[model samples]
Target: MTSLSTVLKESWGLVEDRQDRVAQHFYARLFLSDPQLRDLFPVQMDVQRGRLLGAIVSAVQNFDSPEDIDGYLRSLGRDHRKFHVTPEHYSQVKVALIDAIRAHAGERWNAVYEQAWNDVYDHIAAQMIAGAAEDTEPPYRHAEVIHHERRGADIAVFTCRPLQPLKFRAGQYVSLECHYQPRLWRTYSIANAPREDGTLEFHVRAAGGGWVSSALVRRLKAGDMLRIAAPMGSMTLDPQSRRDIVFVTGGTGLAPVKALLDELTRYNRTRFIHLFRGERQDDDFYDRRHLDEIAESCPWLTIVRAVSDEQGYPGERGAIPDVVSRHGPWRDHDFYVAGSGAMVNATLRRLTEMRIPSTRIKYDAFTDA
Candidate 1:
């Protein structure tokens, strides 16, 4: 008898190559089975389809890890409450998912494969349903856009005032839904520290074909109403930590890093800090002036700018991971990394090789998808 992990791996391998088709087929089957369920999804299925496949892959890969599926799935389930996901909907999804996988896997599909998938779905559904049951927060928080500022060409920073006193720690992110897009939602890190005024800030980097991001960056304006879900993220400030800190940020991943910096300022005593900012080139330095101001005021903070694929960069040249490798040992420092998936993975590998403890590292991979 094949183990559950091995079965899942082999089955996914058969369908992964045709993921787009499988996602399409799955949604088609789902809506056909229960036409009313269509209302829960966005009108745009392109991004949603990819998200489904990504979620499934992530679940399978981490289901049995030490952190286990519960941690990630519970967080996902809680956030999914904002989407109006219910236990009944999970039934439709599982049926659709299995039908699609069987159709795609063709001859590779067997009774054992079917049983393995059934068990996997059962476990996933149990965890998600259990988590959702305990979540008591409102599905979404009402926010009024107080300010919208664009930096360079692709990114926009928005300041919003939650209608209620929205409580969240620095370095956390929330899923945002614009009134204009109806059910469409995107995740973005909060860009500032918790304020007495109870305001929130988000940095959105418009990615091609991202409905929520393009709308947030280019079309959304001050005075527009936005709905934000409860804050989610673990890359938050460690209140007890007194060790030296290292921050590595790429692109708009700088949002959360900036928030941590803001939080650090309120602390009476903070260890020395090193920040590495990575981008395509100098023009992409969207928050340099602000970062410079922070570095200037906080003598403990040092900023290093690195540019890759650009010629004649003045300070540091090459990818951020390479710059971090060639420059510092970073030993004994609490490291925080926020960046694109590739950037985060590369930096973590390098950080481990530099003898940094895995426990001391915190990272969030910023993605609009």
Candidate 2:
């Protein structure tokens, strides 16, 4: 019997040999056959090809151990959710990939090569389908930037067009693509829920090192055309469920949670919402007044602001997990943690220790750093 390890190793070697060629063929076929997918790709084919090939290489190499395979596949499934990749797309890519492999391997390629590649593609496609089933199409008809308010320092609030039409459930995010840098993109959650018109909004903090973000801060203006990917995330209000919702965030991570709160208020669902927001200081915080207004309007919504660098705040004074342990109702509430990787990982660990099931926790790490 050919073990998974053996097959995976051979697959990796085969892929490494022809990864670039496979990527080229894949893009050529996709663009030639499906103009829509071609439009989805950045104009710079080489850069996009490199990214796709690198991702495939990483995916195959990570499967060297069976233990690493499942997690790696699942992560791809989740990532593909945002891409809106379907079974058809997977099939197209698979055919192109296998053909490229055969071309590169020539006489050396045999039944073993066919079987291994088939197995890998099948596993990836199934997981992607599973992820797609859980996501819903975005409700907003059109998105446009109407108002841009500069908050203290690097923070700003962009009130968008379509006004307040449909409510964006808290914890859901919208992918933003800039015209100048089409390949560079970022996702920001709505800071407020639907009000009257169909307008959506976002709270963005300028990351100096981020190409797209810095461009948004410096060059983007009202009436600028911005492409937005559909909203897809697991973190949102569960109306039928009555579990407490703990929202822990840092920086602009507050956007999605605020959207969630808007939905909760609209439906008059009174689930306890604990919002733990961390920033460098009070000045670094955005939407304090709006959050306070929401707290005032909804008695069940408890907003806790944590300034990590400031000493004077009476509420939880340090990291989110510390505040969570001190004042959280973890036993009864589902948790939605967002922000930097370190903060999310720390909060996840604390939640696990607090005996909250992993299934009850949802998170979106905005930045890998």
TM-score of each: 0.95, 0.71
The collision pairs in model 1 are: none
- List residue ranges in candidate 2 displaced over 4 A: 1-40, 43-114, 122-142, 162-168, 311-315
Q: What residue runs in model 1 are displaced by over 4 Å at the alpha carbon?
A: none
Task: Give the winner by TM-score.
Answer: 1
Worst 10 residues of 2 by lDDT: 134-143
Per-residue lDDT of model 2, residues 203-302, tens digit only: 7777765656766666667886666655556677665777778888887788778777777877665577788888767777777888899899888888
Model 1, CA-based lDDT: 0.86
Residue 227 lDDT in candidate 2: 60
lDDT of 1 by residue, 9-44 (tens): 887889888988988899899999999988888887
Residue-level lDDT for 188 in candidate 2: 74
